[model samples]
Target: MRLSELSVGDHGVISDITGLPPEQRKRLVALGLLPNTPVQLIRRAPLGDPIQIRLRGGDLAIQKRIANCVEVCLK
Candidate 1:
């Protein structure tokens, strides 16, 4: 499943992020969102343009388009 599909409070492990460009992938990795990393859905903006997630003990907000490219295994 994609990160964008996860609901608030849901947790998952990233499986792949090949759908994103190199720069985007690097940015995500810098935020500790690499493949195999655990991620928790925190919340989303009212319009859903950006979604908040917890990783590496902090919150990271990503756009919906980027979230769609992150494949994950739900927990």
Candidate 2:
């Protein structure tokens, strides 16, 4: 499933990242979002645009559009 489709409190491992602009993909990878990494959905904005997630012991808020490019396997 796509990371953007994960509900709050869901946990998963990243499987792939596709369709992102090179810069954004690189930034995410640098932030520990690489494939095989564990991830959890922490929260979402009131309007559900930017979603908060935890990975590699850190928290990050990412846009849903960017999240769509992230494929994950439920954990």
Top lDDT hit: 2
Question: Could you give candidate 2's per-residue lDDT for residues 2-69 as a string of tens digits?
Answer: 99999999999999999988999999999899999999999999999999999989899999999999
RMSD (Cα, Å) of model 2: 0.6
* Model 1 ranges off by over 4 Å: none
Candidate 2 runs further than 4 Å off: none
User: What does each candidate score in C-alpha RMSD?
Assistant: 0.9, 0.6
Task: Score each candidate by Cα lDDT.
Answer: 0.91, 0.96
Residues 10-60, model 1: lDDT tens digits:
999999886788998998888788888899999999998799999888988
lDDT of 1 at 26: 93
Candidate 1 matches the true fold with a TM-score of 0.93
